[model samples]
Target: MLPPRWRLAATSVVVVGALGVAALGWWYADGRAAGPLDSVIDDRLISRGEGYEHLLWPLADLGSPPALVLGMVILVVAAVRTHRRPAIVLAALGPPLASLVTELALKPLVGRTHFGGLSLPSGHATSITAQVTVYLLAFAAVGLPRRALLRRALIVAAPLVVLGVSGAMVSLERHYATDTVAGAMVGASVVCALALALDAWNRARSARAARVPLSGQAGRG
Candidate 1:
């Protein structure tokens, strides 16, 4: 379990991410075209020439349905082996459910369409980011020796993976740059919120169990 201080920090991140998703959704409402920031971001984030396609294509495909399903299964199995039900739930259900909320709720309500498809939060970006978050948590759950290098490596790798996938989305015109940002925010927020809820439930259940045994002793006395 994450320390309470760490969980507080995570909750703060979730709040910020949710606000960001909402702000972008509001800004891009009504099928709006690429704004000033989108064009600028596209230029900086994905201006690499054709050779980059070799790398970018595969990174973007990591967010695809088949790839996400496979990754989720592997992560969930890892969590199961560790006997962490909260981690398992986050791994198994978090990404897909978050993706659905973006596709069905946010996109249509925003009415932002690109290439004849709803596109506020890029589903690809959402899936990829959430998957990475779950995998990171699962790694922690595995009870590996706490090594500074490994922790730093994860901190570096997670965002790199998200950025690579999001950059590919912009490069391919699969989504506007802001859409990818919103997708990332949605993915992170949902997963973090779930973690908070599960933690609270576990603490409450433990407290209740402790009370039950005390009540039994009191009855005998």
Candidate 2:
């Protein structure tokens, strides 16, 4: 597994790339403006009909408001159980912050419409991505073992969850393909950036404390 810093960097790249793709589609393409690749993927997924929709509904529902609340409750419980204050704080604040930025800023700034409203970044996609990312980070901070089967399962499941939600949104015609992509990018980027910032703050605080005692001892000597 990558160190936290490396993971942050990787997620940052994804964020930038995904947002760029979304912008390109919004600004440059014609009506629908999803480009051939996104259009093709959306068409294929939509063609699968009721059977696929049934299969995807539950997974997609994970992105809903009630589901997000449940996820937050689970995160808080886990953080308290593990006594991870930083994790608790991060989990508490991160997703809401991401959602605010996405809804209040990016969505309006992009001004792309789908299903009759601004949809450059799907709000549901943003919620699910941010929620999952923060939860995973909280779990890791609480000392979830790297080799644990649950951890391994989460690693595999995260992308699937994002994809499922994005695919469902597209298949259901709730968002354009680029909207979900941008949402995922924004959500992941915000959480990863927050984790890196918190880690750096803690490291700096520790270093300062370590140096303070040494300096005092030297002065006494």
Candidate 3:
């Protein structure tokens, strides 16, 4: 589990990213960056954004219905027979559920226009983020406890790569710089919240169970 301080830092990064995206969007809308230099930057951002856009199709297909169904079937088998519920749940639900909601709901609601889609947040970035997050969760569920250092490194490195690629796409004007930034922010935030909530729920249940045993012992005494 991440220490509280590290979790706070993660939350802060997401909040700042989202704010930066919103500010950039407003700046563009208000014509604050209409000068030649800004236009040049925007052009570059757009060019980079195309790379991200092209990458999206493959990544999105990974989380498509057939893939998800196959994953779930595997997870159910693993969980029911092998007692690997954590691994099963993380693999089957994490990325697909988060990515689908992001693509279908939040992206549409934000309605911040982009080169090819209604873009408040870059779907490509969100897709990449979800992919990394889901993988990280799966690794944590099954592989990380034994090699803590390597696991930690992978967790940190994966998201940064996703962010870097997404940012590159947005910076080159494939998206309004804001769109990619927002996508990264929202994607990370949602996953973090999900993880934290799950942890909390487990902790609470454990605490209750512990109390139950203690109470029974006390009554016997």
Pick the lDDT winner: 1
Give lDDT per model, in order: 0.81, 0.74, 0.58
Give residue 197's lDDT in candidate 2 (0 to 100).
71
Give the top-scoring candidate (TM-score): 1
Task: Show where candidate 2 strays beyond 4 Å.
Answer: 1-33, 141-147
Where does candidate 3 stray beyond 4 Å? 1-6, 10-42, 45-91, 135-156, 167-174
Candidate 3 lDDT at 75 equals 45
Candidate numbers sorted by lDDT from highest down: 1, 2, 3
Q: For model 2, what is the C-alpha lDDT against the true structure?
A: 0.74
lDDT, residue 57, candidate 2: 77
Question: lDDT at 160 for candidate 3?
Answer: 72
Listed per model in order, the count of residue pairs whose N, CA or C atoms clash below 3 Å is 0, 0, 12
Q: Which digits, one per residue and each the tens of the lDDT, describe model 1 over residues 1-221?
A: 55666577669869999899888888889765788999898776656634687777888898888988898898788778878787888888888888888888888888888888898988988998888777655455343326868866877788998988898988877889999999999888887777778778878888999999999999999
TM-score of each: 0.92, 0.85, 0.64
Model 2: how far is 164 from its true place, Å? 0.9
Local accuracy of candidate 2 as per-residue lDDT tens digits, 1-221: 22565556646755784567467446633344565777887887777745677777786788887887888788777767767566777677778777787889877777777745887677888889988888667675344745688887886788888888888988887777777887887777777777767767777787999999999999999
